[model samples]
Target: MFGPEGPSLRELAVQALSSVERGYDLLAPKFDRTPFRTPDSVLESVAKALAPLGPFADGLDLCCGTGAGAQVLTGLCRHSVTGVDFSAGMLDVARHRVRPTGGPEVAWVRGDARALPLRAAFDLVVSFGAFGHFLPRELPGLFTEVHSVLRPGGRFAFPVLAPPRPTRTGYWMLLGFDTVMRVRNALWRPPFVMYYRAFRLGTVLDELERAGFGVGLHALPEFGRRDDGSPRARLVVARRTQPAAGNVNS
Candidate 1:
């Protein structure tokens, strides 16, 4: 649900009809007011989860819309933080909005996540609420790109919520949303790809492993647990196990 400052229904309709980059560009000004932006609670929880594992340098926020995740990196990473996104408009908003004081230097880069412009340049990489833009088929390459940018033993971290069960109304709600998106993409040109159900934990872990990450899951206690006593949200920490063949440390 969007607030009064968020995009209007007509504005949202226009964005849905455009390409993902163009849509986000159009929505950039009001993205933080909308539910689409990653929540502060989630960011705080992720930061808490990552703290013990870090003291990192040179962090990157993959698909960093408006730099929320990059703001988290400023606290954890010591040297610098870079936010890379395909949307110029989002980067512009981030440039003005996400200036953290007296910590790591923050920079913004415009680049596609699938083919990142940097190599072995980051000690950590974090992404928040951007994976839905990538289709399931693209996961392998996406993970590979993340791995390629991270230095040896560096982490690619993000929080993932446990999928809602069929009995929950939230389950139907997400299913409906994904169905509508699929239909929209089917009928529209320059398809806007977003599917709530597409990113499965098992499949994603496999892809992360295949891309040379030694993956681990950390339970986020802030979100509590499910009825089955499993964690409701988890931080997926995928560490790059080795350096690329010829990557010079940056």
Candidate 2:
């Protein structure tokens, strides 16, 4: 649900009808006011989980929209922090709004996650709340791109919540949202590709391994657990295993 300052129903409808990039462009100015932006609690939890593993030199925030996750990177990394997103409008909003407080020099790059422009660069990489835009079939290329940009022993980290049970209201909400998105994409050109259920952890872990990453999952205690005692949320840290061209330490 959106707030008083958030996009109206008509604005949301127009955005849904447009391409993902264009829709985000239209929505960028008010995105933080909407429920679509990653929450501060999640960002703080990730920053805490990453703290012991870091003191990193350079970091990247993949699919960085309004740069919330990039702000998290500034606290964790020491040298430079870069936020990359395909939406120029979103990057413009990010550039103007999120200010880093001296931990690192922050920069914004407009680019696709499937084909990143850099190579063997970052010591840590983080993404927040943007994976649903990529379909299941695109995972391999996307993961590979992340691996390519990270230096050897560098990490690719993101938070993933456990799927809601069928009996829960959240389950039906996600299901209905995905169904509507499917129908909308079927009838639209330059299809908007947001789907709630497309990114599965099992499949994603497999893809990360195939992309030369040694993956690990760290439970985030802040969100608590399910009835089965499984963690409610986790941070997936995928480390690049192959040796880099230079003997650079991460």
Candidate 3:
């Protein structure tokens, strides 16, 4: 669902046809008006969930489009917050939009998440609504990059919704969306890599473990629980374990 301030259908078509970076650049200004932006409710829920675990120092928001996660980090992190994304356009908007008052200083960096430009400088890292851009095979490398950026005992946290069951219309809708994306990639140049079903929680936990994070899940009570008593949404809190022999924090 998009508001009147959101991109036009024609504009969206142009974006969908472009490379992911260029597409986001074009959509950056109107992103918050669209459903693509992480919802404020979700952000608040995650902040509440992370508050007890933190009194964190420096924080990083990986793939921080428009700086929503960075805004959250300001409340929990004491020193500084850095938002890194590949799209310069998105970073531009974030720099202008997310100024905090009497809180952690915020900075924006333009870089790929696969190869971050910084050292292991962050005590907490958060990402929101950006993982679908990465394929399942890329999870190991992506998680490793996240691990590398975090200080020893630092956390990499993000929220994941419980997948809609087959009985729900949302399930078919996501299935159809992914199928369309697959078909488009097959026929189009410079594939747009958004898939709703690709990031499974079980697979992600295993990858986090292999990347040397001690993974845990915290239920977000705001979203309530499913009929089976499992959480409807959860925050994956992956803490980077101390480095092995010969591995340095820096």
Best by lDDT: 3
RMSD of 2: 2.8
Best by TM-score: 3
Q: How do the residues 47-105 of candidate 3 rate in per-residue lDDT, one tens digit apiece?
A: 99999998899999999999999999999999999999999999999999999798988
Q: Rate the local accuracy (lDDT) of all candidates.
A: 0.92, 0.92, 0.93
What is candidate 3's TM-score against the reference?
A: 0.97
With candidate 3 superimposed using the best TM-score fit, by how many Å does residue 227's alpha carbon deviate from the native?
Answer: 1.1
> What's the residue-level lDDT of 170 in candidate 3?
98
lDDT of 2 at 18: 94
Give one digit per residue, the lDDT tens place, for model 2 in 28-77: 99998999999999999999999999779999999999999998888888
Between which residue pairs do clashes occur in model 2? Answer: none
Evaluate residue 76 in candidate 2 and report its C-alpha lDDT on the 0 to 100 scale.
Answer: 86
Q: On TM-score, who's better, 2 or 3?
A: 3
Give the poorly placed runs of model 1, Cα more than 4 Å off. 243-250
